[model samples]
Target: MSAATPCVLVIDDEAQIRKFLDIGLRAEGYEVLLAADGAQGLALAATRSPDLVILDIGLPDREGHDVLSELRQWSHVPVVMLSVRDAESEKVKALDAGANDYVTKPFGIQELMARLRALLRSRPGEPDAPQRYDDGHLMIDLARREVALDGTSLALTRKEYAVIAMLLRHAGRVVTQQQLLRDIWGATHTQDSHYLRIVIGKLRQKLGDDPATPRWLKTEPGVGYRFLTDH
Candidate 1:
């Protein structure tokens, strides 16, 4: 497959399943790469930077959840967990670990393709992330660093707007407090959690968002925060 083609890395120890996905996904216009274990999958992910990943829960080297956890530490590439076990708890665990979606064995290729289409459609990148963010009552001109709530311009403090803009750039994913501190404040301020708390509170107030029940920014509790991407 050409380097420009949309790449999918399939990580499964089962050779037959890997072969099946190789054929099926290629037919659907995706460039396919296969890995037989979690270690190899992680290496592929780090170096290849494929657009999507299909991970199997039962791998020889590392359990799928552990791989997903490690992957989340460095990459936000969309991952779909494939497993023969159809347990609801397993699905929930994978989802909580940051898998974009989950699929079971004996699954129809059409259904998997449909899910992939939906996931890729929402994935953030060039041509997907708009410069301006507008959601009915709230509007953000990212380039201008301007914000308006309910048609009226909001006079946000420097830190307030910075927090909002940073959150918007990473719309769906959690931005850890350490990252926020380093990015918004300075590396020196990474230890100052209070700075982040104060800024987020003021930003919420400016956006007319209630901390108790967020309308735009949601708190992830002890980790960080993520902006609502539905808009």
Candidate 2:
């Protein structure tokens, strides 16, 4: 891999899966870090701060979801989940737990690579002063960390502001619950989807979005959530 190659951490208990990912990612010019379980994965994450993490749902020592929760308490590094479970509910659980994206078992390498590229491209750019986006009466000033509705300013708490900022940064894309929790509350709170729900509710209220019929913040049912800019 080149010196400027992005680093990826693979946390899977299955040796075969890890090896497969290691080879595939290396071919794409990424430096890969391997961990056999969640504990080792967390330690490597803290020490190496890899650009992204590819995590398995089932680990030998700890549940992948738990690892994700712990990572969210402190890191904003992107995480893509790998799982054998194909049920939508399971996928939602992973996303709700803060995973950036997920790949089901038996996934094609091409699709996985594409998702990785899309996610990396979707990551927030370097921090800058909050800037404003306006579509008629809806306005958001990121630098000031403020939002306004039809010329009226809306009050928002720290967590609320963080969630909105995240949505704005990734506008038009889904912001996984895990990513939000990690970004807002840290990795340790990623698994607490209730926190995410509460903050989103407050955001919707401030934005004048009806929870019953939301126009801005849209829920993806079992998946995470998305901020609809087309509204």
TM-scores, each model vs. reference: 0.55, 0.55
lDDT string for model 2 (1-231, tens) is 123788899999989998999999999988999999998998777655688899999998988999999888656788999999989998999999999998999888889989888888787764553367788888888877778889888888988877887887767665667767777898788678899998888888777788677777887554467777786
For model 2, what is the alpha-carbon lDDT of residue 146? 71
Clash count for candidate 1 is 0
Residues 70-188 of candidate 1: C-alpha lDDT, one tens digit per residue: 88975788999999999999999999999999999989999999999898889876435557888779999998888998899999888888888888887776667777888888878
Error of 1 at 130 (Å): 16
Global fold similarity of model 1 (TM-score): 0.55
Q: lDDT per model, in order?
A: 0.87, 0.83
Clashing pairs in 1: none
The residue ranges of model 1 lying beyond 4 angstroms of the native Cα positions read 1-4, 125-231
**What lDDT does candidate 1 reach at residue 70?**
86
